[model samples]
Target: MEAVFSKEIQSGLDQARVASMKKSSRLRVCADGKKQTVLRMWKTGFAMEADAPDMRGMVDLYDGSIHLFRCLVVTTAEESGERHYEFKRATAVRGTPALDFETPEHAPAGLIEDAR
Candidate 1:
């Protein structure tokens, strides 16, 4: 499948990685505080390494719900040898597409505003 990331997002992902050393594990993935985040990325593969502090701890959608897990960040060379991350303390998550935008709807006459 095609990789799904914009140039800006890609750049941010790259910047998140720490410089790889001969025997250093610089990648860190952390669990999110919100339950919904854990529900969003399960099952979807992590072909490329994600940004730590940002993409870390995101719940992957496994069988059905948001489950927590961890991934090791490695260099491209290291990934080429073995690309799959081993998840631990995981919870199942259901994937959901991110919102593109949010805007106020044009109100019609007699429409009650929700903010009251």
Candidate 2:
């Protein structure tokens, strides 16, 4: 998985969801700022066409609503030269921020843990 700060999605999200475009985007890092990379963030919400229903004569017409978020982080040693870019999808629940990005699938456990 790569953490890509998708510029296209970010711009589109900023216009559609005005409140979520925060100014700061820094990676979680060690005390010396030498171990991690954090990139910009873009959050948006959209819907996709749903697949057909199961047997029994019911068909789902919509894929339900989904939230999309992208982030750009530098590649870790584990990832080799590839940059870290991410895209997350989550369901929209009541009272939840509609455009918040989901957690990274492979974030480092911690400084000491990652060092191992």
Candidate 3:
């Protein structure tokens, strides 16, 4: 997919400066088509969320490099007061440095422990 950082995303990153100052990693934003997605990543784990006209409540989580373990959740509105939820799991190549997946001792908190 094609993605690019946009002005609105830059503004959000600017606002996240406070968090970065507090020792939290700065968040990154990229636009895929008309949708904007935010990604907050640290050494241990990362979280991504997206909301747009065609998509809403999209989330993805990963531990470490994000190529080994992943959990995705997509929520779509069906009708009045109704919503559809879809969940997916995948193991894909990210072309990043390989990580030792045998140990979870340093795994980030709030990650889906059983995502595999």
- Best by the lDDT measure: 3
Q: In lDDT terms, how accurate is model 1?
A: 0.36
- Error at 21, model 1, angstroms: 27
Candidate 1, superposed: residue stretches over 4 Å from native: 1-46, 49-58, 62-77, 81-83, 94-116
The 10 consecutive residues of candidate 3 with the worst lDDT sum are 29-38
Summarize candidate 2's per-residue lDDT along 1-116 as a digit string, tens digits.
97666888765654444223112323222212222223232343211111111112111111122212222222222122123222333233344656567778998877764565
lDDT of 3 by residue, 1-116 (tens): 97677878865775465335324433322224231222343333333333223333333332332423333445443331123334443334366768776757877767566776
TM-score of each: 0.19, 0.16, 0.21
Ranked by lDDT, top first = 3, 1, 2
Q: Model 1, 35: alpha-carbon shift in Å?
A: 16
Clashing pairs in 3: none
Alpha carbon lDDT of each predicted model? 0.36, 0.29, 0.40
Best to worst by TM-score, what's the order? Answer: 3, 1, 2
